[model samples]
Target: MSTDASGGEATGVPVTVTADAAREALSLLEGEGMDTDVSGLRLFVQQGGCAGLSYGMRFDTEPEEDDQVTEQHGLRVFVDPASMNYVGGAKLDYESGLQAAGFHVENPNVESECGCGESFRT
Candidate 1:
């Protein structure tokens, strides 16, 4: 899978990953025994949740033919065209705190999110 630089502005990548997120993703990929060069995290939007849309993510051996792949801190992220519509200009971040610790998507496209914060509506 080909990859563009982390800068979304230069590459027109829909989503960008924070340094913390990239580090966590790379560690996860290594733990799974996936080749960092060929494998990546897939970020996509799905129809579900309390609101109209929700985000989903998983590890992929490679990006799909139509995926927009971006590289950040040596970690690759794959975003599909459909998902791009909802997540464009979004930031993927990783936070480790006493209350929460995981990946989070800060999407500018989101108009509103559900009370539970599990879903969103554009």
Candidate 2:
């Protein structure tokens, strides 16, 4: 995979991370105090959101066989092939503010988002 300021340019990489998100991810990973080489962040889309789909992310030490792994700005991100359809081409950002604080996803494929902004429909 070709690592860029935005994210990796890999064939199966479903989502891209903004520079802000990448920096924040690196900080968060460091905060966990795990070996950076083996630990990474995993992003996925799952069923059962108010709008039919929800996004998920977590730190993982091992990746599944079907996962598409990419590294950018010293952060590793993994995305399973099955979740790519819904999140492909999406951009991830990290925002810290009084109103909202966390990772945000801007997905081009989303047709609608729920009122809470926690779920989406493709």
Candidate 3:
């Protein structure tokens, strides 16, 4: 695993972050006093949820040695190699409405999702 941005160049970016999502994430990071230049959002897939796989995200201080780092809309995103396999070609977006307001991932690799819409199978 290279510490450089080669992971993105090699496999392409696993996910794309929308303007809204980037804005929200940057704001959250600022609130936490994390430097925007060194801190970023970590997006990954974990085994769980009713569909056997669930999406997980959090603020990471920096990318790991094996993490694929990509930047868009003034935000940096980190994705590990294993998780990249399942989330490749996914888009991260933020929605705000009376019914719902949160970050959502539009993943092209999804084959099916649970009824509650919390988990998916690829």
TM-score of 1: 0.89
Off by over 4 Å in 1: 1-13
Model 1: which residue pairs collide? none
Q: After superposition, how far is residue 1 of candidate 3 from its true place, in Å?
A: 18
Mind giving the per-residue lDDT tens digits that candidate 1 earns over 1-122? 23433323323445788999999999999999999998999999999998899999999998777678877788888888788888878999999999889999999889999997779999
Best by TM-score, which number?
Answer: 3
Model 2: per-residue Cα lDDT at residue 99: 81
Best by lDDT: 3
Q: Clashing residue pairs, candidate 2?
A: none
lDDT of each: 0.85, 0.78, 0.87
RMSD of each: 3.6, 4.0, 2.7
Candidate 2 regions off by >4 Å? 2-10
**Deviation in angstroms for 119 in model 2?**
0.5
- Per-candidate TM equals 0.89, 0.85, 0.91
lDDT rank order: 3, 1, 2
Give one digit per residue, the lDDT tens place, for model 2 in 28-77.
88898966776778889998778999999999875666667776667777
